[model samples]
Every structure is written in C-alpha cells, then in structure tokens.
Target: MNKTRSPIVQALLAEISTFDEAAAYRRMLPAGCYTEPEFFAFEQAEVFSRTWICVGRVEQVAERGDCFSWEVAGEPILVTRGEDGEVHALSAICRHRGEIIPCPEKGRALRCPLHFWTYDMQGRLAGAPRMGDAAAIATLRETVRLTQLRVELWHGFIFVNLDPDAKPLGPSLAKLEPLWAGYEATGVIDVPPAMSDTPLPWNWKVQVENFTDAYHPEFVHHGTHDFAPSIMPGDGVRFTDMKPGDNAIVRSVPMKTPDGGMMKDGWGPDAAFPAIATLTPEQRSRVTFAMLPPGMTMMFAPGTIAYTLIRPAGVTATYAGSDRVTYGGWLLPRSTIDLPDFRDRCAAVREGGSKIWAQDVPVNVGMQAAKNSRYLPEGIYGSLETTLQQFNVWLLEAYKRADQATR
Candidate 1:
C-alpha cells in the first residue's frame, strides 16, 4: 500500500484517540471491519420495521391479478395486483394460524396454502374454508385483514415501509421531485430484472463508506483498471477532492473518432465527454449519488434517471435492486429505454468496481475484530467521511431509542 498520505489522512490519524468511544458508541470502523453491533441494532428496529424498503421491481406484478412474494428484514410480505388493477402490500402470514400464504405460479388473489384461507388482492379476507357458519363469516372477515405494509411505486420501483407511521414514500421522495418530474416528461421508464444478494463480513455502513471513498480506486482496482492499457493511460489514478452528495455518474459515449483505441484518460480526455453533448442544458446540471437512511443510489445522467434499490439482509450484508429510466420530456416524444443491455453493461462495470470494493471489505472486518483490543487506535473523521459519521450517529441513536423503549 502507498505510505504517502494526505493532510486529511494525517489529521484523522493523529486524532484517533478522540474518536474511539466504544462504551458510549462502539468499535471505530477502520479502513475495513468484519463486525458492528451498531449496524445490527439499526437493522432490527428502524431498517427492518420502520423504513419503507425497496423489495422488488414494479413491473414484477404489472398485470392485474399478478402477485410477488418477498422477505424483508425477516418479515414475509407479498405484493399483489388486484382485479381492480391496484397494487397492494400485505403481510404474507395467515392470520388464522400464522401459516404463510404461498405464492402460486400466477394468480391475483392471495390464498393461504395451509388452510385454504384466502384474501383478496387488497388483503381483505375474501373466503374461509369449512371453519364457520355464514353468520360467523362476517366476524372472521372483520378479524382477518392481512397486515398492510405501506408501499409506493416510484419510477418503476416499488418501495415498502414497515412503519405504518413513517412518512409516505412519495412526500419523502419529494425532495427529489425535480429529477422525477423531469424523467416523466422525458419518456416512459423501463426496469429490468436485477440479480443481487448480501455479501458476508461487511456492515451496510461499510459498503456505503466504500462507495464514497473514491480515493481507493487506483490502489484497489489497479489490476483491472489501472494496468489495463486499453482502459488506463498511465499508472491509473483515483479521484481526490471528493465532496459530499457528489455522484460519479458514468455512461458510455459513441466513439467520436471510431473507437480511438479506447482512450486511457478516465471519464474523458477532454472536458467534453461526447455523451454529455447529447443532453439538454437542464440535464447538464444534474448530479447523481447515494442518499441516506439506508437505501440505494440515485442516477441522473444526461438522458437517464433512476435509483438503485438496496435492502440490508443483516447488519453486515446487503442486497441491491438497481434499475434506470430515460425520457425525452416535451422537447422529444417520451419513450422508455430497455435496461437489460444497460444493466448488463453496468454489471460489468460494477464487477470491476466490486474488485475495488473487495479491498475495503477486509478493512471493515478487521476493524471490528480489533475493536476490543486495548491497543486499537481511536477512529478519525473528515468532512468527506461525514456520511459515515452520520450513519454511526444514527445507529447509536437507534440503540438508545430501543433501550429507552425497553426500559
């Protein structure tokens, strides 16, 4: 590893003692760590129950009578398309005996497989088998509405909130209204199937921190991106001077000079990346990056608008549901771009990105392991690490809340 360090790195290292507060907080997250109880506590209460989680793509249950079953934060939930053509989210467990309603190959109604108890697509008890008389049926119906999970469809993704009292996803997302409104004006949005799962030995915060640390690219992905003469010009470099809320948006441009032998200059050799020219002035000002409260990233490139869907499986494991949308607005007729091709290409890029991430994952694991050691250094924070610090604060606060509730 390069021993040469930045003033920021030096300042943080010098103050390590100030940040190590395990009793009041927990272990400090080093460059990498394997365990974090703070992350686990948040997952149990807020992330698992209170927040609206993105479970799957909206198109999964597009047709009326269609349904999709998913497990989020250990809760079995199902989203179904009602005969009336509305989408509904409901607890997948049967109210009768806590039996799970199995998702059939294709169906609109939710039926409990164990006792043949059935609920409408809206989660109302529609029928009961052999249990009671007609007079008692009304009582059963009143008693057995499937617990509803707050679900909202945005762009082409479906987000569900375990907390009934939580702010609606729409108003919550109103902060990004400009991006969404612009996307709708541009064209119809399309979503493709996403393949993702949780990785072992890394906290969710660790993953987000890694994404923000663009400084590691050169050292971590050196073999794939740095050494590849076709992709890198010289000894490859990582971006410095990172700011919070800044996004490293990426896109492919049609070769200007017919594949000028894959320019090594990262992003572009000149200021004008051919692709940006294709966008409107408004699009030019758009920025893409990940937002907080435990979710995926938002991308607003010249012609595309989308957010990746992230669900933490455990304190240290995460799953991603990524998709995108492109529209022409009033200037151009609206049309949605098919994303299979885009996702496949991005997947390759993400694959390359993952190698770089692999280098940081160990750091999180190691930090967790060394946290209990008396010799372990205190953690440090910088402006760029504000997000990580904020996450830690949020997690610790959550533990405080959980403890208060218990007391």
Candidate 2:
C-alpha cells in the first residue's frame, strides 16, 4: 500500500481541506486539462483499465451459486458465487479460443456453449468434453482456470478490478471507514434495469463537478424552490473550504419555515430550498456528507437513512446509480420484497432529479467548449467546490501513474 502512495499525493491530501480562494487554485492548472483529447486517452488506458469499478449492485450476485456478468472498458467479466458461498470476480472469457462462458445471467456453473467446456462455481475446470487423452486432459486442466480479478464487498456494494495486481479495496479505502459508521441502510439493495438516460454533450468530469456544486441549488433547482413556499426567498448557500482530515460532517442546515417549525416534506415554503431533511437526526445534528472518491457521493442523516450515487461506467459516459438503504444489515431474498415497484419508485426519483439536472447540461457543455477558447483559461471554484478540487487532483494522479508506466 505504501508503494502506491506517492509523496505528492500525501502532501496534496494533507492540505486540501485548508485551501482557500478558488481563483488562486485555478491558476495552478495548465490550460486544456479538462477538455483535451490526450487526457481522455489516458483516462481510458490507465484509470478505467486498472481500477476496481463498482459496476453493479451487491444483490445482483448475492446468493450462493448465483452470478452476474457484465462488460467494462471492453473486457467481459463474470462475478460468481463459489461453493463456499463467497462471491468472486473472474474473467468471463474461456481460456480456449477466448469464447465467453456464464452466458445469459446467474447460473450454477460456467459452461461454454462453443466448446462444451464446463467450469464449476469456483471457476475450476469441471469438465472438458472433447479431445480427451491423458496428456490432453492434463494440459486442459492446467490451463483452463478462469482468470481471476480482485473483488471487494463493502457496505453491500460490489467492486471489481481488471488489474490482477491492484491492491485490495479495504486498505485503499481505510480513510473512509470511520465516516460510514452507524448509518442505517436497507440490508437489501438493488439497481433496477430501468434507468433514465440523460445524454449530456459535456465531458464526464463536468457532470461530476456539477454534483459537488451545491451553490447552484437555489438558482438551478428553481422548480424546487419556486413550488415550495417555506424557504427564504433567495439565500445562496455556499460551502466553505473542505479539509482533508476534517471529520466527515454535513454542512447545510435544513431550512425551516418562517413560523419556525419543521416542514413535513423537508422543504421550506421556498419550493427549491428544502429543509436539509435528507440527513438523519443524528447526522443532521452533526451536519456531514461523505464525499467518496473515484465517483460516489453519499448523504446520510444519522440513523434515519442514507443514499449513495455510484458511477458504474467510466468517464466518457458513466452510469449514476444509487442505493437508499438502512444500516440494519438484514438479508431477505428478492421474493420477500416488492422489488419491482420499489425499482419503479427509485427510477422516478432519479428521473425527476435528472430532469432538473438536464437544465445544467447545456451550461456544462458550453463550459467544456470554452475550455478551448482563450476566454476561459481556467475557472474559479468555491468552498462548495471542495469535492470538485478533490476529483481533479485524483484524476491528475491517476493520469500521472499511467503516463509514467507508458514512458
């Protein structure tokens, strides 16, 4: 782990929380850092190829003998449940002729249709039906184990790494462990196939930057502010410098009605300004939001509940999926829950939120286009933009390593 940690990164992480003045920070960037083609190429080769991406929900392959298959960065992967009942990630391609196995969803064994080769739940060669002799069978057994990838299960989320040599997820994420303590998440979770597609012409980073820009809430989510009557008419909320070692805490206070009572729907009279009802009473009491890296944002309100947004796909066009669950850690089968209807509700929430976000897409795309113009050399960010800076630094480091490797 120390080998992967660089001094530059250490220094940067230590000081980010105390940094002030978004304008001074903007001067530090070289021109075209956000919109250039070279950066995009590096992202595809280095970042997406080597990292453990959260491609799907944990429940997708939760049961023993269950499996889920998906492709990432053009690589086919099969995540399977072993006989021991632990989930494992393996390359979906058969060692022979590179044919894909574990086709068409979860299955007891990974069987290749092209050659009739079979691998057990653990990915060991179970049977090879043809061309069998003493030497041939020995050769087949020795070479046929499915290529394994690093997999980690944390808080009911599944992550897979394409680089077999990458570090396990736990140690890399150790710094964030303390922040998640005590949040109630539904022990059961799922990402329904139904998802809204908001195709933004803007770069992926632009979309992420928007997620952290809470300063725009009052102005951009105007519908929310306009319809609700309790919020103050025009208070522009701004988050200040976010410190690295600072205890994970939410910053915004839920808006209260002029009458000074908690609003039923968590919003003030101002349609856009919602009383920060999203936080658990405990978390709201503390005022904190967990800014997870490599593309996940979470908001928790104490014991009440929590929501996480994960970027399953890579930067070109990532899929933002959320899990709203409790910390109780209950494990009930899908049949026990009204999964379909629940999925519909989740879809509706995301779609509604996205319709609001759609308004920002053009602004972001125009910003991306301006990156190439002499007019926008670099741009300023605010305290609410702390996560924005964190993301850029992370992106730069990922690029630096991959760049070094190529050289």
Candidate 3:
C-alpha cells in the first residue's frame, strides 16, 4: 500500500496541526483545502463517500410506495421505502445498460423505462424480460443487485454511507444525545423543510466555519443582523473551544432577556417559538450549536433548533440538499416547537428565513472569491472563534483518517 502523502495533503496536515487550547488560533486548515481540485477529490472519496453522509430527511419519501432519485458527482443513487416499512438507498443506474433512473419515481418497484428490468424496493432483481432461457435469467438475478449503502436515521435525519462497513451513525453522535435530551422527539415534526442552494466561489468549509463562529457577527453581519446582540472579542463572553476528536460545541452568552432581567439568555423568547419543555434552566438560558461533521450543524436554543442541508459541489463550491452542503441562514432553521396551526406564524418563519438568506449570498460568494486571491492570509481565531477552531480540528482529523485509510 502507498503510504506517502501528496504535497497538497501534507500541507493540510502541517497547517492543521493540533494546538493547545491557549495556543494562538491560526487558521489551522490550509487554503488549498478549498482551492485545490485534487484535495477536493480526495475529500470526495475519503470523506464524503466513506463517511456517514447526511442527504436529507426521511420526509422526502415518507409514503410507503414512494422513491426518490439522486445524482451526486456522476454517482446515481436511488432511495425508496418498501411496503415492509423500511427505507433503502441503492444504485440508480440500470444493471443492464447503465441508464439513469428518473428522480422520485413512485410505486412498489423501480422499472427502468429504457429496458424492462424491474427491481424491488430492497433493490433485489424482480424481473427482466426475454433473457433467452430460464437458466440465464436466474443466473443474472442471482448475481445482480443494486449496490446498497449503509443507512441510519438519527432525529429524523437520513444519513447514507457508501462504505458498507462504516460505524453506526448514532454512536458517532453519542455526545450530542444528552445535550439535546430535553427535546421531545415526537413533537419535532418535519416543518415543511426549507432547503436552498446557491453557488459559492469559495470552499464549502468556509460556510461551515462562519456559521457557528460567533466572532464573525461583529463585522460580516454587522448592521443587518438584528436578532442576536452583536458581540465582539474582549467582550468578556468567552466561548468554549473543543479538543481534538470532539464532535460538538456549545457556548453561552450573556444577554438581557425581554422579561426585564439581566441574565444570560437565548434569542428573545417573544420573537421565537416556545421553549422545549424539558430544557433545564441553563439550557434555556443560552444558545447552543452542535455539529456532525464534515459539514452538518445543529443549533439549539430555547425556541428554535436549526440544521443545514449541505452537499459539496467541488473544490470551491457547494450545493446544499445534496455532495458535501451551507451558509447557516437558509439551511433549514426549524422552531423547537411544532408549527402553530395558524398560517401567519409559519409565513413569518418563511419570510424571516428568506431575508436572512439574501443577506448571506454576497458574503459567501465574496469569501469564495477572496479564498482564490493574491493575499491568502491565515485567520486567527479569538476566544469567540472556538467553534471555528473545533470544527477545523475535526476537519483535519477526518482528512488524516481518510489519508491513513488510503495508505
């Protein structure tokens, strides 16, 4: 096995070297991780393909007879729910002539329109017309089956892994189960998922970093951002940074609540939905964001819980709802409470989300353009940028693991 690392990969390793908590927080990840095509391809195979990649919610295909077709980076995928009450992901390419199946095709079986080959919901061959003799048909059926991905559902999120032997997704996110234990799993309905995709001229990781890093709000979102009290470094509010191998991050900030009390609190309870009943006093007092990498973030607060539907586009871009997905804004921020029966409240959520997302596009695309610039500078993460440092650490570790596996 080839154990040597590519210059690009080696550059990444050295850039994101593990540092002490008090160490200067240099932009640990290399700029090339976003700009170089080769590095992106490595991530595609090593990270996206092998890891438990979050695609979308099971609500996308809720009906028992429904199926959804997907294509990412030329790899055709099909997800369907069988009558047996199970969801499955399989290759959407026809085994006979390699034809792509149309997306979201319904019914019990996937019948390739071009050829008459039919496959059951579980992806087992059901029928193929006029294949000479019974022996030939049986042999083809015995050996041919759609490639199946390892899939698991966590808190209504559907994640699929190309690697057949990948670890269970639940255990990987063990640290998060308790933090979010307060949420009523049943009450959290799929509120008409708000999915948006826009082209970024920068690497997908930048979006991931900017989302949870509280430091950026001081400038990037300066005037337009009205919801959260804008905070800057040396403001006496220190965020907790994660050590290597940490899968999540949580930080509490001091804010004045609308109830006329000067206490650390969440986004104003009035503008937000009702708090999850089970949240403890501290949990309700502040906002928390948890991540399931290489790019999934879950934000928890008294009133709302948000997540991204990210999919990677390439070296310097992303297509949310699909490869590796996100600016945190339009990335599906749902209320912790169920949507009220009233349409106005739901409309408010939709309208507010649209406005915020509009403000994010220029910032993201500009960052993308800057990443490919004459002055590629390393950023120093302040105490407030702990989330960024933690995420970057996770990114580096994932790359190292992927590299080691290749070796």
Candidate 4:
C-alpha cells in the first residue's frame, strides 16, 4: 500500500487487494470507495488525471479558428482548430498571470480578459500588451506558448490526456472498432450534447453503473425499456470478453424487432429516426452499449449512435448530458438529417429519453445513498451484471497501478 494515500484510501486498497479476478466477480468494492472524500481525492490524482477523457466531438471544431473551452482533471483547457487545419488541445491558463482564457469569437485571437494578452488558435503567444520593449516582446512570443496536452480523435470523439507520456488511446479501444464501421459507412454527423447546468447528486461510478446494468430494466423501466428487453426468449444480453489492455465494458441486448430504436414512448419498433440502411442484419437486431471508463458511455442503436459524456465534480456529485440525460448527443447519417421532420424526430427522441431518465433518477439517488448505510452489503452480481463486474476490475487495475507507482 502507498503510504502517501489517506488512511481510508489505504484501507480500501488493502481490501481491494484481497479480491482476485474470479473473486472480484462475486463482490463489489468497499462502500467507502464510493462515499469517502479522501478516496475521491486519491482517484482524481491517480486515475482520472492519467486516463483518456472524452471532451467533445470533432465537428465542434471542424473549421480553422473554431475553438471551445473545457475542463479536464480540474485544469481548464482549450480545444481549437488551427490555421494548419489540425486540432490542438492547450491549457487555457494565460501564460502571464494564470487567468483562465476563454475561446474568443470566430476569426479573433484568444484574448485574456484581465490584460488582453492574446494567443493564436494553436496557443502560441501572439501579443502581450505593456510587458516589454520590441525585442523583449519577441522573446516572450518565442518562449511563452501555452502547455499542450495529448489529443487523439477516435471515431470523431475528441479525447485528451493530462499525462504527457501516457500511452495512446487507440489500442485500448480496439474492441469498439468493429462496431463503428457500419455507422461510419453511411457518413454519420455528430450533434454534440449540451451539458446540464446543475450536477446530479451521486458518485460518477454510480451514474455509469446504472447505465450499464442489464438486470434492472425489467423491474425499473417497465414501459420504456420493454422493447429492448435484457431477458429475451432465446437471446438475452450478450457480453464481450475483456482482455488485459481493454478499456471498454460492453453489453448488447436483442431488440424485439429489427431496426427498433427510441420512440416518443421509449425504445420501441417505431423509432423516431429511421434505421441506417448500411448496418449489418445483426447490428439492426441488437443495441450495444459501451462504457469507456472515467468519462463516456455510448449506445450503438439501429437509428442513431447515441452517447453521453460523464464529468465528475466531487465525491458524490457528477454532471452528465446526452440524449438520455439532456438532449442531442447523436450521430446520424445525412439521409436522416435530410428528412423534412428531422426536428420533430429529434424532439420525439428527447421525449422518449426523458421518460427513461425519470425512472433512473430515483434509483441512482437510492444507490448513492446506500453507500452511507452502516449495513451496506458486499453486493452480489448476477450473470446479467457482467459489465458492472468488468468496471470494478478496470477500476481496481487503475488503483493498483497508481499505488505501485507511488511505491
């Protein structure tokens, strides 16, 4: 155990060490892992800071000079498209006095609000008013570029890493590549999610566990999730084998009918958005959900590829947004976008997603609240909960690695 970790976190790590691979499948991690502020602080420094966090879609900065401000691991960063037509992720803190710099309006340089220090889209210092003479200003321009983070684009999703020497994000996500070809074949376009202003009162893990759980839909989401039942007649939920370096925890459930998707009532046969003609017969018959730990969740449906971005704010505070949480995190083909009733279809999908979300809210709250209970059980997992178990394993590995590094 790392002596640097808080006593609570160290105790949790000791408990985590007792669970071998097979044993991990039978029990959940200690409740303190979810409920303790000290453990959350350790996670922020160890896990999240080193992981690849999905920020937004590539379409958000499609054109040169397009940029947006985002926060990763508590550091405000700017994602921009430069004159060279490449995407770059740079620290948003101004080089001079550390005031956070917001993305400027189109065709304008990123200017600090405090002193009008300006930088180009690529984060190179362009001007600093009243700091020095001509020669000194030129020297400052040569030496004062903002710190750049590592960026990798995976299937149009923009991911950034705070760790300078962290391994590439692609190989870890190779499992998800096979599922993407069909969606990309017809040329999909992203409609990025608008994050909620208010945070949800739950641990980030609790939010994702609710998203990945397959056993609860029958009881919890009676009407809305019936069309995509986890317990189908012959084929129930199918899980992918997690390899050593794998990052995604995935499960797919058979749809009641081919091409079924989100409707006004919920997931059903008469989907608001039409199915993509290019998808395989198997793809059309099932809905695959993938959780990329520490940041995002994705749904591979017949009509559209839906996604949600997870942002953890505190030990029990998480903020998320997507089709289910808020509105519009969709990737659809041009054919669907060209439909005359596309706006109505989008609204219907949002309405259906809202109903499903309403059921999830209370259950999530209850799950988070249970962590504080004196009698919280070492939870049992059924076969249907393989994804959750996989998530536990992933987190354990991250925690272990961080602990070993500190030693």
Q: Considering every candidate listed, which one attains the maximal lDDT?
A: 4
Give the per-residue lDDT of model 2 (tens digit) for 1-407.
12353444333423432333443345434434455454444455567777666655567667777877766555788877788888888888887778888644455468898987888777888778776787897787777798887887876667787877776766665544654543323233343332224434555566556655555655766654333221344632324343532222233333333311112222234222122333245333332344445444544332222344444333244455432211121122233245455444334434444555566666676766776677654456655555556555555556555655654
What's the best-to-worst order under lDDT?
4, 3, 2, 1
How many backbone clashes does every candidate have?
17, 35, 8, 0
Better of 1 and 4 by TM-score: 4
lDDT of each: 0.51, 0.52, 0.61, 0.92
Selected candidate, larger lDDT, 1 vs 3: 3
TM-score of each: 0.67, 0.70, 0.81, 0.98
Model 3 compared with the native: what TM-score? 0.81
- Model 1: worst 10 consecutive residues (lDDT sum): 324-333
Tell me the deviation in Å of residue 196 in model 2.
4.9
lDDT of 3 by residue, 58-133 (tens): 8877988677765443367887786678888888888889887554356547878788788877777778899768
Q: Looking at model 2, which ten-residue stretch has the lowest summed lDDT? A: 323-332
Model 3: lDDT equals 0.61
> By the TM-score metric, which is better: model 2 or model 4?
4
Model 3: which residue pairs collide? 202-368, 310-325, 311-322, 311-323, 311-324, 311-325, 312-323, 312-324
Q: Summarize candidate 4's per-residue lDDT along 138-179 as a digit string, tens digits.
A: 999999998989999999899999998889999999998998
Candidate 4: TM-score? 0.98
